[model samples]
Target: MSTIVSARGLTKKYGDFTAVDGIDFEIQEGECFGFLGPNGAGKTTTVRMIHCVSPVTAGTLTVDGSAAGVDNRALKKKTGVIPQEITLDIDLTVYENLLVFARFFDIPKREAKARIAELLKFVELETRRDSKIDQLSTGMKRRLLVARALLNKPRIIIADEPTTGLDPQARHLIWQRLRQLKAQGVTLILTTQYMEEAQQLCDRLVVMHQGKILKAGDPRGLIESEIGKDVVEIRMPPDRDEELLARLGPLACGHERVGDTLYFYCRDGIGLWKALVDLDLPNTVHRPATLEDVFLKLTGRSLIE
Candidate 1:
């Protein structure tokens, strides 16, 4: 696929403070590209620059062959944004909210009406079209936001934490719609804290921390590369670290102690599992390595705040 978004040494700053510290990455066309990080890790800052909302303080960012900047109307016209916040007009009905947004893109009223009808059905909100925003549930509001973003028929869609504050059913509905868009060849740029969301939607992604890209790869590939195949967590007292390490450490590729648990990372857990069983240790959990494990291992398990 062709590159839709490209950044090199991209940086963002607010006076004396830098939010995005010279990161570089590329997003391919028709693929769901994700930015994953903790709060204040510059994920939002980076996407804001990509969508041309925030100005770049340094380096270069180009989207669809044009330089990304605040004044780039052509770029803006081709991009749609699903903001992290619920920015819907509460006083307006669901259909009205999309109607006003279509006007901003200069979409003709007749065409806008046709598109709105299709979008409401696309997002499964057809029955609630005349309902006020306050009458819709959180999930319905989010679905409407998705439909609103589509009014312009954007080539690229930027979704910042799109499923935030949603239950599983609601979140899955958004995911299905996003996947459908990807299938139809819309380039998706996503920034989310949910690891499962990233794993589900992203064709490729980068993990950012402290204003920098720490790792970038396919989800499963990154997990295997950074965290091996299996993880065994033993929730024993911290003092048992030496005893556990002396017996099981050699069978595992890596080991770490956090809080009251001893984590063993290995390519194959059969040996580690047997060793643990022999030792008959209590509170032991052996499971497959996941994207979350890689994330925590790279970013540290401690709270970012």
Candidate 2:
């Protein structure tokens, strides 16, 4: 449970533009730590620094007791990366792809062969070992990426939007594999925009916006603190806001109007739900407050662009 990654006033810049503003957070060993944000929110930038591919422009960044730097070979050797993009060699067979990657780590020929066999099976691609990367489906390619990352037997794994284009079953399979890795004590550093992914995998996460940390906590704790226990959504015209607020406002802890819907955040939404039902209001829904709710509330529900 010791700190595996730590950053203090961490910052990253590209010439005149700053991609990661001053931010600070710590990741514990053997836990899935997440960086959650929308496109261009610096989640990728922050994690790139952690994995030592991108240089830090300012402040301190450390991983496993060493300062993070572009030339930090020791850190790089023990770290595995599942990049967002599919970086496999399309012309090579599944087995060949892994074979080449193992060489990069200087894994011996005999040992590499043994590990490759185990990994192909681990990702459930044993039957497709001889098949070309181009012949595999998107999910299959993603699984191969997972296997490739593990070839070095890394202590830390950085998964940057690893399940980006996968279907539900494929995504779940990836999740299961990741959980299995975590159970084996691999420190997982994840950067994703998927709130559900963060909630499902992360023991804790930071919600970033405009290159800055807006909030950080365990998912459920953040949801409860920022959004209460339940959410009541009423898809009514905005003009009715005042009328409904007069009657339902006192029963709820907080309320907001976005588009045609009025949202009520309550510690217990049942009472407010009953009030709305008594009013015979149409298009009303009562649901649990989720990480998505906390995300939108803190980062703004509007599109980032």
Candidate 3:
């Protein structure tokens, strides 16, 4: 696959505060590339520049051989954005909402009508076409937002927290649609807080914190490289941590104490489990290491405000 989006030392700032520091990454054509970070990690700002909605303060960002900038109409024309916030006009019916957006793209009435019908069916909102935006449920509204973003046939789609505040069924529906788009060869740029969402869609991703790219790789690879095959959690008092570590630390590849839990990251949990059983610790959990473990370990377990 060819590189569709490339950023080198890309930076974004507001006044004296730097939201996105000098960071670099490349998104290949027809693959789901994700930006994963906690709040205020510049994931949103980075993508805003990619879709040409926000101006780049420094360095270079190019999409499909064209420089990405606020005034780049050609780049914007081929990019579709599903914003984090629901910007639907409640006064208009579902069909009218898409119709107005089609007009923004200068789509002809005949073509717009046909496209709207197809998008509505694509998002499974065909039955709610005539309903007012306010009359639809939250899931229906989110689905409509997805349909609206497709008003213009776009080669690249940027979804910012597309499943925010959605139920399991709704979130799965959106995930399925996104996967379908990827299968159809659309380049997808996603920024989401949901670790499961990133694991489900992204072929590769970067973890950002304090305006820096800390790590980048495929989900499973990152987990295996940074963390091992399994994680053993022992919940106990802080005072007992030293004794536990001295006993089991060598049995595991690594260990860390965060809050009440002592995390033992290891390739095989059998020895660790036997060690724990020898000690007879009551509060212990052995489970497979996941993307979430890598995320928390890289970003820190504390709250990010």
Candidate 4:
């Protein structure tokens, strides 16, 4: 597959803080790629630069082989962006809002209407076409934003924290539409703090922290390779660190103590688990290493604020 988006030594600095520090990655055609990190981890900032809204302080960025700055207008026309916040014209009805986006791409009169109708159906908002944006539910507004983003039939779509404020049902609905877009061959680069969202929607991802790439690969591969196939958490009293480490040390492939939580990563956690049981550790739980496990293992922090 051809590379749709490419970044080399991409860097972004605000004052003394470096948001994206010389990171590089390629987003291939027809792939759902993600930037997974918590707040201030540079995911949003990187997305903005890729969307051509934020200029890179140094290094190179290219969309479809054109320099991000040299061909921004063309790049913007070829890409769709759903920002962290909804930017729709809430005063306009659903149909009108979509039509407006189509017009922005310079679609002709007859073409814009046809495309708008199609998008409404694609997002399952056809029944609410005539409703005002604010009159729609929060989920409806998010769906409309996605529908509007598809107005130009962009090759690449960038979403920044797309499901941040949505409920479970609404989030699932949006994920469904995103899968539809992927099936239609739209390359997606999404920045999300939600691990499940990333795991379910993104085929591959890069987990970033402190303006650097912490790890990048297939979601399951990252978990399997970085942490392991499974994890066993032993919540112990703060002062019991020495004893707990001594008991878990032999079985753990790698383990760390963070506050009251001890994270143990190993394949076949059964052996490690048995050791813990024999030692009679307090508040023990054993589970598979999810994307969440990899994130915390790499950063020693939670994804949510």
Q: TM-score per candidate, in order?
A: 0.98, 0.99, 0.98, 0.93
> Model 4, 53: alpha-carbon shift in Å?
1.7
Q: Candidate 4: where are CA atoms >4 Å away?
A: 279-282, 302-305
lDDT of 2 at 34: 93
Give the runs in model 1 whose Cα sits over 4 Å from its true position.
none
63-136, model 2: which lDDT tens digit per residue? 99999999998999999999999999987999999999999999999999999999999999999999998899
TM-score result, candidate 2: 0.99
lDDT of 3 by residue, 172-258 (tens): 999999999999999999998899999999999999998999999999999999999999998987898778888899999999988
**Candidate 4 lDDT score at position 98:** 81
Question: What lDDT score belongs to each candidate, Candidate 1 first?
Answer: 0.94, 0.94, 0.93, 0.87
Q: In candidate 3, residue 189 scores what lDDT? A: 96
Better of 1 and 4 by lDDT: 1
Lowest summed lDDT window (length 10), candidate 2: 234-243
RMSD of 1: 0.8
Q: Per-residue lDDT of 1-305 in model 1, one digit per residue for the tens?
A: 89999999999989988899999999999999999999999999999998888899999999999999999989989999999999999989999999999999999999999999999999999999899999999999999999999999999999999999999999999999999999999999999999999999999999999999999999999998999999999998888788889999999999988888889999999999999999987799999998899899989898997
Ranking by lDDT: 2, 1, 3, 4
Q: Model 4, 185-204: lDDT tens per residue?
A: 99998999899999999998
Instruction: Give the better candidate number (1 or 3) by lDDT.
Output: 1
